[model samples]
Target: MLNKLSLLRNKIDLLDIKLLEILSKRLELVKKIGLIKNQYGLPIYVPEREKYIIDLKKKEAKKKGISPNFIEDIFHRVIKESYYYEKIKKFKKIKPDFTEILIISHDKKISYLFKNMLTITGYNIKYIKEKNLNINNINYLFKNIGMLILDISKNFFEKFIKKLFLLPKNCILIDLSPIKEISIKKILKIYKGPVLGLYYFFDYQKNFLFKESIIYCDGRKKKYYYWFLKQIEIWGLKIEYMSVIEHDQYVFFIESLKYFFTLIYSTFLIKKKISFNKVLTLFKPISYLNIFILKNFFLENPQLYINLITDSKNNIENIKKHLDYINNLSFVIDKKKKIKIINIFNKIKNLLIFNK
Candidate 1:
């Protein structure tokens, strides 16, 4: 009986050894995945993919009569280890055209964000926070600046544009402030250097790792624009270059108009002493996005909306005209008739600037 017990103990020890070896092999496979993800500049932790993996493991565990919760706990540890390995691994360095970037912004938060992002991607960054940047500092500030990011407020933008001539001719200009088309043309006329107008519509607080960025290209400087595109991509920004006119139009309709309408609706609700929170609780099935908008509407600073609405009057009018045209279209019709009428509109649009 003692001899038989010793042999069984030895067999159990061998099984434990085999399990360790299998786990080691699994880690090796995970390392390979990290390498692949790094090559494509992909994020290490993908929430949807992680959910899929956990669900799959749970299903497999049930087939083997194993506790699903037990399998989930094991996978959680494994996934954590994989993330640690990925974090330890350094990313490949990308050699850009220029080494240093100078960020000039009135917003300290934005300046800090740019500094962090640039530092992560292996670039030397200098951040200058000034409500109204003194022209005297241009001498040292412009020196060795590969790219100059102008995130100035609209109130101080015209003055900032006047000072663009002080920048070194070699330094690529990236303008983020909203300016009139005529004003942009007038400024570019004097500044013979490369300039790229950027209209960042997406909220800076929102994650834009996979989202697209709209950039307004100026002066047809292909190489300069490409360099800017590559620089932004290094920080995981997807850039879309469009005409200045188109950029302004989109901003007016999508950003300015939307904010104005939200403000109007929010104001009306407040005046009526309506409890949006209570209404939101009653309509729990409604989308969280709509709820978020309503909740934050009154909390938003009035100055921002005022700036957008007043500054984008021309583009707002253009959008209004487009909407009026759309409203004039006949809506009540048979399915076949509606299809034919829409086809005619599509055909007309192809010949117009608003079409695809």
Candidate 2:
């Protein structure tokens, strides 16, 4: 029996080697395709193509009497790796007509992620921590910098803007502040050069930039900054242009409101004195996703969420209105108005279904 088991294990190892060889050949084809996509300025991630491949594989797996879901899970991971390799081969370095690009950020991880991506694509990139910014270094650094990226905290924005005079008049400035109005306003007041506002929906922890969207607002000269935008596209990011007001409004709803809801839900769970471990065990698939989101929220810096919730007075007012809406529903529940609740739910359900 032991001899038979050993023989089976050897066969499995041989099959694994064959699988690796196949994957290598597949990656070579992916690399060639990536080059063509880059040459034609096409997007790296084609969702319809991915969906078709997954569906095709699942059907084949079913025909072979294998679990379709298991095959799907395997293909998803394989496709993700393919994307990674494709991007690595697809980067066409567009050397900016600048001496160097300087990235200033409070977060080291954020600074380094941009630096690495830019550097690999053959751009000269330098990083300076926000805390280390002083008049002397500002003078020396800005003298040769072709592009200045401000990813610093809002608290330092005013102070940092005061030093923009040191930057060359022709150098392009990019602000990565979440609050576009404030940063753009401050920077425009001080610097008359070409300015651009970018808010990245990036998860630096994962180190994957494929298909990530960046909210960009043109501050000064679009002609000067257009190349920079194209460079980011080549790196597999999607640029979404919006006005300053529109960007801020969308951020309030997308980020602030979502965080507020997560906070309220987590607070409710804590107030009920429920065991989190037990709750996890009892959660259905949807509930499990909710729990995962809640867990991820807490894993980040608490101060970041605090600032997000309190930054805008309008956001606070909106949160109050949300609470009032919830309170009204609670009152209806207390009064056992089942017909009213059902009517409201059905109206909302129909509206959502129609919209979808």
Candidate 3:
């Protein structure tokens, strides 16, 4: 009876701690929004952006197994309070709100995501339909706009990046559909494509492919491992230096090639349509878990999957090697080979958990 009471007390303590944590997060976000507005000279109350954010909250909540309506009601109250804070400024100095945010994209789904994500934060969001927006007039159009989110569609971006670069604001640019450019021209007497302008190169058209960088856009906006360190002066994050070309090559090799081969292998395994009971006996728990994660990621972004193959060098070699090893697997295979693979798996497991 005493033990049960102690357990209940512990649970209560945990609940209290979690409640404090959530409050802390809310306060921090409030401060961050205020700071960002101060730094960028933007307003605090933006209805359009707020609507977009609330929508995103609803969508994201559904994914995380939360009620969208609950998130919406909570955020609506939060936004109103924030607006009052900005307008009153009785407690402290408040920043002015931005009236315009221009998003360029052809995909309606992504536009909806962006629209909803911004509403909770309260900013004015705008869109210039790709077809209606003039390529040459982008510079003139951006004269008064505060923030610009480019979709990085090559056909669209190639015509106006130079002009957009001239805007005198804290422009945060993210390339959505970046083509990995080749870098051999300087030393090999081959053609090198321009990095930041109209002369951008893609891997599929090249005679000999090389990669320059790997760019990934997970849901949250954060820098990649290699990019953060190398660009400390500019990006001020942790990254190790590798040329964009090499990065793309590695991504193509590891991501593009491996995904294709494994997908094929998985398909074959399923095609035989063997009994689930039999398959479970042969399956490794760790392998099954890894496959589950990979399946989710693959389904999330087709562009990323395709880019991995079309954007790299040396991927084919790696894919073939792994596939050969996979195909050669049999119940009667050498014990030494089995042990080697097992040791490798153990090492990976250890390395992954060591830091955590």
- Top lDDT: which candidate number? 2
Q: Write the per-residue lDDT of candidate 1 for residues 1-356, one digit (tens) a residue.
A: 99999999999999999988998888888788777766776655666787899999999999999999999999988876766565423443455446578888877544566566567666778887765457555677777777787776665666667677877766777766664464457557767677777766555664323334556656446576565566565444556766877777767777777777777677887899989778677775757777787666556666656776667549567657756755555442433477768788788888795554
Question: Order of candidates by lDDT, top first?
Answer: 2, 1, 3
lDDT of each: 0.68, 0.83, 0.51
lDDT of 3 by residue, 188-285 (tens): 12211112101122322222111222243221123322221122211111223334455455555555666686667667867988564665577798
> Which predicted model would earn the best TM-score?
2
Question: What is the C-alpha local distance difference test score of candidate 2?
Answer: 0.83
In lDDT terms, how accurate is model 3?
A: 0.51
Off by over 4 Å in 2: 1-24, 37-42, 48-77, 135-137, 269-272, 277-299, 347-356
The TM-scores, one per candidate, come to 0.64, 0.81, 0.43
Report the lDDT tens digits of candidate 2 across residue range 58-99: 999999999999999999999988887777533676654557
For model 1, the stretches where C-alpha displacement exceeds 4 angstroms are 1-93, 108-112, 178-183, 201-203, 206-208, 211-216, 294-301, 319-356
Q: Which run of 10 residues does model 3 get worst, by summed lDDT?
A: 190-199
